[model samples]
Target: MKKLLLLSISLIISGCASFGEGVTTAFLNKQKEKDLRECRVDGKSFGGMQGNYDGSNNLLKVLMVHGVGTHIPGYSTQFQEKLAAELGLDEMSSHYKEIKLVNKEYPDQDLGVLRVRRLLDQEQDEEMLFYELTWSSITNPQKEKLAYDTSGEYSFRRAEVNQMLKVFSNDTSPDPMIYLGKHSQDVILASFRTAFCWMMGRDWDALPNESQELCTVGQTAVEHLPDEDFAIISHSLGSRIVMDGMKSMASRVSKAQEGEPTSTEAAFITDFQKKRTPFYLMSNQLPLLDEAAIAEKNSASLKFKV
Candidate 1:
């Protein structure tokens, strides 16, 4: 019953036009001129990408993580272009590097994809690497239970608006629920983890091009961690993923520090502590989701200390 309620809420919240705009159209239009769609940001403000590309050989990297919907590799193209223009980066690579993220331990599992593009200023003095992580494929199999409902056999019987709502619900409502399941969240986190490694470890030329691979925190990442800047842009469930992923990373580092931390782990932890990696969340959903268990009392602090 609780799950059903959450699903219903998700359906309503996930941009069902009829349920949303339909009911509010008259009032919205009446007050549209007077209504203030204010964006209230509550947190410490950090300088955005502008400061990251200081022409110092340090690369500015941003990763885009989508929330609870199916998305393709090129989903961030338009946003990337706009961001590039805002950053005064007019030149972009003709091709993007694609990686089919897979965990070596679970080779059969489809962890989703990482698409990378390089953006440069007109003079080529400043550069940014844009990484787009499409992890919807992780929860897709679970959502397929509703696939038959969307078929003409069943969808034809519903009212047009109802059908659209049902399809929207089918596509999005199950993601949070699936992430709550046994290992689904783990798989999604692995997808995020690999993307982070790829973002930190290599430049545009070093990344694999159109290949299936797993990324590990290696020497390259340890060496580059000090010089490069990293940030994340996420929406919806992605905010939760980034939060949890950072906590998980902190847990590993904390545990390693307990005994004897390896050189790579030590370097990563030390360098990570020095840098401020900001997360820009759109339609952030961390408040709506259940919090994961954290063994450390200050795990949240540890997560952000980096």
Candidate 2:
């Protein structure tokens, strides 16, 4: 019964067409609350990005990371549009830039893609570059193992609602499992790293458009680290990735700072820490996804009246 309730909730959230509109509306109306959810922010307060763009000298850059489930490069389109409107960014570049995230050592691996859009005010003075990272491709191959179970050959045997639940399950259930794998975790983090590198490396004009090339930090990329501001917007499991990725980078930066090295990598890592980039996480599950014990389940038996 609990599992069925969870599946029903998922169906409602997914806006499955088969769900009765009247029932969906009632459920959503109940959820559209009188401010019942408590939000507690545990960090230093920061300013908004309204006027952060200061001509050519300073640039406001925002990177977005998605959560569990399959996502395409343009998944953040609606959000971006709304954000732009709020910021009074009435104009944008004719074409957005796209870069394929790749690691030099793992050339054959399809890490993911980064889509970048440049937004500007009517005066073309205030500007922001929004980067959307789509890393689902990295885990899609592993999820293909469940393909047969979701196929019509098997799905036809189940009830309609059950089949829908199974399809949704097959789509999202494997992500955290796949992320738990050592190799896949490393690869996903690598994808995030690549996206960060690209965000740091270039401006709108300097960025590569539609390419599967890897980004290198280089001397020049590190030089601009101080002039740029970065923020991350992430949802659900993506919040975990962002947290883990930042911790990993911060650890490296801390080590490099201790050594006081002069290499490009060392310089970049040290400066990257100075940015103090903020993360605005939505539907975050970081508390639930403890890296050390994510797979551990409570051994105690539940006492339920059957």
Give the number of the best model, judged by TM-score. Answer: 1
Query: Against the hidden true structure, what lDDT does model 2 obtain?
Result: 0.83
C-alpha TM-score for every candidate: 0.80, 0.79
- Candidate 2 structure, TM-score to reference: 0.79
What's the count of clashing pairs in each model shown? 0, 0
Clashing pairs in 2: none
Candidate 2's residue-wise lDDT over 155-272, tens digit each?
Answer: 8899999998998899887888788777888889988988888888578888877888767778888888877888899999999899888887778678877886778877677677
lDDT of each residue in 101-186, candidate 1, tens digit only: 87775789898889999999888888889999999988887788889999999988999999999999889888887887659878
Pairs that collide in candidate 1 are: none
